[model samples]
Structure formats: structure tokens, C-alpha cells
Target: MTIDRSSMTALKVTLIGFAALASAMGVGRFAFTPLLPLMQAHAGLSLRQGAWLAGANYIGYLVGAMLCSMRVPATRHAVRYGLVAVALLTLGMGVTGRYDVWLVLRFGAGVASAYVLVGVSAWALPALAGHDRSVWSGWLFAGVGVGISLAGLLVLLAGARGYPPAASWLALGLASTAVAAIAWAPMRAAGASAAASAATQHAGRLSTDDWRLVLCYGTFGFGYIIPATFLPAMARDVIPDPAVFGWVWPVFGATAALSTVAVALGSSRMKSRRVWAIGQLVMAAGVLVPVLWPGIAALLVAAVCVGGTFVAMTVAGLQEARRIAGVNAARLMAAMTAAFALGQLAGPIVVALAATNGTRHAAGPSLLAVALLLAGAWALWRSPD
Candidate 1:
């Protein structure tokens, strides 16, 4: 059977969207976590300061999401402009040597990354209908895993070859630029068509139920980021083996990718909110494992669980937001993104308090936060539609 041109076009656009998301998320966000040690050793930043610098990115992301939510011509042009901004920011990160300078660059990169994510999703979701949209959305989030894996591998390779930190950052930036170029053509082509017009309009607003979904999703974002941002460092502190550190990130990425698929399948029959809550509970359990056991095995298990839930919660959250918001989906999604970013910004700071006593103690507050938020999500799911 022959597929229509629109179907083929949508498929291409979907692929490109995945690539774009991978670059934007993997290289832009996850890369920083792994590189934190390098930055500290080479750049002379304290743990507290490093955490704050990381939080700065999320703060910028929150601002960017809120800005995109407004109905402005420039905001509407974010799909193309955002991609370009992120690509440039990624490259800029390579050359900056000073901590203050790097912090500013990371904030800029965060803003660009947030815009690309919100804009692309706003554009991509309308190209699909019903279950296909949900499925594709899961796949799109999985792209982040792929990107993380790629970034991990690159970092490993760079370290092995004794490449300077600056060079490694540059290589990732180039990879992002390549992906952006490939994505631009199809995104533009897709956006020009009649179907694109309808999809954009369909993505315009948010309903009351969408607000509930956003709150739950925002909580998930808060719960999940603490572990994700710090897991590698946690593993290193516990394991201290270079070999183990190398494996931790890739394991997290691969498992997270697989988990996104699991979430998509599980949610096929389950409510999106339920699926999201389940993922969060799993994540909470993961975060607690290392606290309870303090071993390499437990750390690895924690990595897998946390990684999986991260993508799953994102996919479920976005789908629920779209479903509840209908035409106002983009605006609702932007609000949710802002809420999520706020949670992320707060996570490191909250966890750093735990660090004062010891890194392990931080797990208590982190797990509690995740549990409470997830329980709230479950409650929301059971509420009237």
C-alpha cells in the first residue's frame, strides 16, 4: 500500500524533531552534569557554586518557557530561531574558560534549549492524531536518551584521548549544529503546509483540567531532576572507580530510553496521570536505593529507575497537557514547562543542604519530595475529569 505525501512528510518531520530534541536536551542539559567535575577541577568552582550555576540554567529555562507562552510574533518564530540560538550557544560553551562566563553561557543555552523544546513540541504534536501522537511523543522524548548516550560516549572518548575540556564541548556543539541543519528543512516544510496551520491552531490554549495536569507534571519534574542531575557524582563518591563513573551515565541514558517505551506501552490502557505517578514512584524508589544500600549495585539500579521515569513522566505530562488543553495545548505546555523548570532549579539547592551533613542524607529529603509529589499526582488522577 502506498502512503500519501502528507504521511511521508509527517514521518520525516517526526524524525527531524527527534534529532532536534536529542541535541537540545542531551547536549544542552545532561552534558553539564557529567562535565561538572571537570569544570570544578579545571575551573576552581565549589560544589555549592557549581550547583547554583546548574540551577541558573533552569532559571533561564523557566524564563524562556514563560516568554514563549506569550502571543508574540517573535515567540511564534521560536521554532527556527530557538534552534539557531541553541546551536550557537552550544558552540559558545566550548570557548568560555571562566566560571562566571560559563554560568552566563549556560543560562543562555538553557533559554535556547527551553525554547527549542517547547516550540518543536508545539509544532510536532499536531502532525499526529489520537494514539499515534502519544506514541510519537514518547519516541521524541527517547531522543533525549539517545542524545545523552551520545554525549556520554563523547565525553568518555574525549577523556581517553586527553582532549581538552574546551574541545569536547566544541565537538558536542558541532554535532548539535549538524542535527539542527537536518531538522530545519523538514520543520520548515512541514510548517508551511495546511496541516501545519491546523496543528498550530490546535496547540494554542489550556483548560482547567490542564492546570491540574501541569501541577502534577511540575511536581514530577521537581522529583526526578534531583537524582538525574547528581546521580553520576553520587556514583563516583560511592564507587570512586573511573571505570564505574564511565559506565554510569551511559547506563542511565540507555535505561531511560527503554523506560520511555515502557511508559508509552503502559499508558496505552492507563490514564496519563496514573502512568506519570507510577513512573514517579519508581523514581522515588530508585533515589532511595543508594541511601538504603550505599553500594555500586544499588547505585546502578537507581540510575536505571530514575532514568526511565524521567522520560516517561515527560511524555505522559505533555500528552495529558495536550489532551486537557485541546487548542490551548501550547500555552498549557509552556506553563507546565515553566513549572517543571522551577522544580529543577530548586532541586539542587534543596539537595545541597543534604550535602552539608553528607551527600547521602540529601536522599531523605529528595525521596520525600518525590513521594509527596507523586502521591499528589495519583490523587489528581483519581479526581473528576
Candidate 2:
């Protein structure tokens, strides 16, 4: 089927873009959050063990992002295959009891998620920009939050009916596969023209502002990742009931979707750099909220703060790169993603090492360090270049 890009309206394009992201990222990547406590309940995972699993996934993400920046042929087909691979990896998690197997599956899922992310951005953003419908890109980024919320809601319902974490994994995998099928053809065909187009970019000659963006991006990764990874665990420890604390992930997702949409609607008046800076600062405050209060209420607030701003910061930072780098956006985006991946990769490792003392209580000081790093990112983002 020859799909005509010109014939597709903004609404269709937006939904297709959203499905691609929702499938690849929302379920493929984050179905882990709600599954974490369930894994603890059923699979006997400790905090440090869980951090290692998450770390493996982050390392895979860094590799995928780096590969996405390279000029690869038939990338749309690669993305389609990647989505199928993600679905399989997600299902594989349910059948495996071995921790090493779990790590490899999660790592594969991470690679798939990055492919979908970069592929969708490569396909959808430019198409929307061509149509003057760039605002719809918010819906694209918001797909991650939506995926997170949907998976959370699914697990919440499953737990209410006494479903195990394995069931949750299977259900989310099926859900991802279903969505992947719908967008498979569209995603495979949507952005083919740009797949081969790499703008001329000089390596080893980044400007001061470019390095600044990379540093801030990395710090934002470190800042958001800890709370993002462990928030539900903290909630489960405190609440001990899936039905109640399960709501936290959904709330985080809701805040993220709403906030991204709101920011996108106002992007014309607000510069992406400013938006990125504001998001970094707001995320810093969110990271601190749970630390200061340490309860369901504060955790919920932390969810909103982190979920709401992380996507916003992502949109702002990546879009800002496009604004500054023009056709060279792909290279710069890849560099920033590598740095960001490094930051998140370190986040879980930090937690794992901190927990080596055989205490789950190591998150406090580590998170405090993450918050301070976010503060420094905010300062760099605001300081004159």
C-alpha cells in the first residue's frame, strides 16, 4: 500500500505519531514501573537487583540512540521490526524467572524504545513542521506518559482482580503488539524521505552553547531518573497496597501528558531554551518534594513534578537543538541523547552501589545529590552563554 504523505491530514498524522510512541515507549519501555513492586512481591527482587535490571535497559537505550544517529538504510522497516522485537521482549519478561534473562529482555526493550523514539521523531516532527502543524508534536512526546498511565491503569486493575506481575507483563505486551500493528504500516512509511537525509555537520567543533546544552541535558537525565525509577517502590514500601499506590504512576502520566500539551500550545510565545530551563528548575523542586515530606501526598506531588516536567524538558531541549542546529539537528540530538543516556545509566548504578550495604535506605542521599545536580543544570540553562 502506497500511503500518500501529502494526503494525510494533521489529525491522522498526529494519531499515527501518537500510536507509534505509545506502543514503543509507553508500554514497551515503562510497563516496568507498575511491574516493579509486583516483581518484588512475586519474584523476590531486592532494590539493588531491580536497579541492575533497570541499568541494563538504560545501557541498551544509549546504544540505540547512538545507532539512530547514524545513517542507516531502510530505518522505517527497522522501526517496524524493532516494535515487533519490543513486543516479544516484553512478553519474554513474564516467562523468565532468571534475573540475568530479565536483564537481557529489559535491555532489548530499551533498544526498541530508543528506535521508536528516534524513528518517530525523524518521521513525524518534520512532516508536522512541513504542514505548520508542529504543535501536534506534543502529542507525540506525550505518548510516553500516556503509555505509562495506560500500563499503570492496566496493572492496577489486574492487581485488584488478583493478577500477578507476570500477567501484567503479558497483558501489556499484547496491548503493545496490538497498537504496534495499527501503526506498523504507517510508521514504516511515514518518514522514509528523511531517513537518508543527514545534514552536513562538522564534528569536534561544538560551540559553547552546544556543550552547555549537552551538560544541562545530562544533568536533567540524572535528576529525573532516580525518582522516576524508584518512586513507585517508595510508595509500595509506604502504602503496601497496589490499588492505592498504583495510582501514583497514572497520576505521573496524566501530569506529563497535560503539561506537554500545554507547553506545546504555548511554544510560539516561549523559546525552547527558556522552556527547557523552566522544566529543569521545576523538576528540581519536584525531586526535592518527596525528600522533604516522604509520604503518599508528597510522592504524588513528586510524580506530577517529575512526570510533568521531564517530557516538557525533552521537547524543549530537542526542539531547541533543532532550532540551533538546523539540518545538523540529528547529530546534535544524538550527542545529547548519549549524554542523557549516560546520566540515566549512572542513576541506577548509583542506587545499586549505594544499596550494596544491604539497605534499601540509600536512596535518600543519592536522590539529594540528583536534586543538586538538577539545580546546577537549571543554573547553566539560565546563565548567559
Candidate 3:
């Protein structure tokens, strides 16, 4: 069956793509953010343990990204099962009692999320291009923010109701399953070929442009993830009120969703590298905010800045990879995703190392170091390769 781009079908597919991501990235990957505090409170989870769990998830993400990049056929099937796996692993967390189980679940969730991300990027992005709806491209990525907002609110509501952390994970998993089901059929119908991930050209040697894009992307990943992983936790230390600190994640997501849409609506004529560079600058400021101000207000400001810029930077970097790599974009996308995952993996370890006397405040210096790394990445972007 042929796809009808002339009708509303294309739009539906686009939104389904968004939902696919929301399920994979939003619920599967990020449900930890709002749930992190709950674990600390009820499960006696330490910050160091949490960092290890997060690191496990990131390592899984890197592995998943690398596997999906191997030019495997039937991406649609892989994604469908991955979505189901995300739903199941998330539900599994609620039922588990051991930290070992939690680590496994987080790692499984990471793998499922990466499969969806890579497969969806392959399927949806090209479809948008074929339909001349490339301007709506960023909306596909906006699912991350939407998922973050929803996960945050879920935790917030559960906290308000005095529900257990396990209950929150269970409820969110149930809801995410429903969303993933909606996305299942569309993606299954679109195969691996739809993604254009396989290279059509062989002049695939990495050019100067490719390396710079990859470097800046790695920085963006390292920079945004610190705040992404710990923003709500940081706020919890300052306010200690779940109700108040909970809003941080939602605000971050709202800003992310809006900024992603804004970037999408802007002219495609804007160069991807420029957007990537500007996003890094804003993200650095966000990472530095709490380091400088050290309060709820500063934390919220950081959330908005970091949330808003991360997804936009992601969109720009991948688009830049595609533009630079041409028909070989899949390999480049895989490379960038791997780099990003490595950066994500590094962030949690850095936080653990920075834990002065095993405290969050002691980690401030390391965060400041993260901000500086982002600044350095900005220089790499403009430097003549």
C-alpha cells in the first residue's frame, strides 16, 4: 500500500511519530526523573546508586543505538517490540524490590528507548521530507519534552495523593502502553528502507565538517544531561517539597516542547550548525545558573534554559549530520547518537566523582566544569577545522 501524502495522512503519521518518541523517550527513558526522589524517600536509594542506575541506562542506550545502526532489516518490527519492551520494563520497576532489578529495568528501558529513537528517526524524518513537511521535523523530537512533562506531572500527582513510588511507575507504564499502541501499526507498516539510513554514496570518509558536528554533539549531550538527570533532585535539596520541586520538570518539558516547535517553525534555510552553536551557548548558561544562584529560582531558570535548548540542539545536530553525510546520514546519525550516549554515560559518573562527602552541593564544582566544557564546544564549532 502506498502512502498518501496529499491528504491528512501525512500529518497523522507525523503526529504518530511524535507519539512513538513520546512513548520511547518520554515515558520509557525519562520516567526516572520524577521517580528519582520517590526512590530516595521510600527505597533508601542513595545518590550514588541512582547515578549508577542512570549510567546503566545510558550504556544500554549506546549499545542499542549501535545495534540499530547496523543496517538491520525490519526496523518496524524491532520498534514495535521495543515499544512493548519499554512498557513492560517500566511496569517491571513498580513490581521490583531489589536494586539489581531496578538497574536491569533501567538498562532495558534505555535499550528500548534507543531502538525507538533510531528507528523513528529513520522512518519519520524521511517521510516528512518526502511529503515536503520538513518544517514540522522538530515536532517529532518534541515528544521528549512532552514525555518529560507528563512523567513529571504523574509523579507530582502521585505525590499529592500520597501514592507510593511503585504506584507512580505502574500508572505511567499503563498510560505509555496505550500511547505506544497507537504508534505501533504505522511504524510497522514503514520498514527499515523508509528511514533512508543505508548509505547510497560511498565517498563516506569523514570530512572536517562531520568531525566538528560530532564533537559539538557530544558536548551538547554531556552538558544537557547533567541538569536533565539531576535538576529535580537539585530542586528537592533546596525546597524539599515535592509539590514545589516537581514543577521544575514540567516547566522544563513545557519549555522544551515549545522551543522544539519554535525551531521547527523557523525557516529551514537556517543552517543547522548555527542553531547547534547557539543552543550550546544557552545550555551553558542554564548549567551555570544553579552553580551561581543556588536556589529554587535559579534552578527553575536553569530548567527552562536547559530543557529548551537540548532538544533543539539535538534536532540541529542530526539534521546537520544528514546534510553533511548526504546519503550516508544513517552511519553519521549512529555515530552522533553513540557520541551523545557516551556523553550521557560520562555525566552521571562525573556527578558521582564530584559528590563532596557524598553530597549534592559538593558536586557544584563539577557542574561548573560541565558548563565550561560546553563553552569549549562552542569554540570547536567556530574553529576552522
TM-score of each: 0.89, 0.92, 0.92
Off by over 4 Å in 1: 1-8, 72-76, 130-134, 193-207
Per-residue alpha-carbon lDDT of candidate 1 for residues 20-67, written as tens digits (9 for 90 to 100): 778888887778876665555566656677677778788888888878
lDDT of each candidate versus the true structure: 0.71, 0.77, 0.77
Better of 1 and 3 by TM-score: 3
Poorest lDDT segment (10 consecutive residues) of candidate 1: 1-10
Model 2: how far residue 328 lies from native, Å: 1.5
Q: Could you tell me the TM-score of candidate 2? A: 0.92
Clash count in backbone of candidate 2: 0
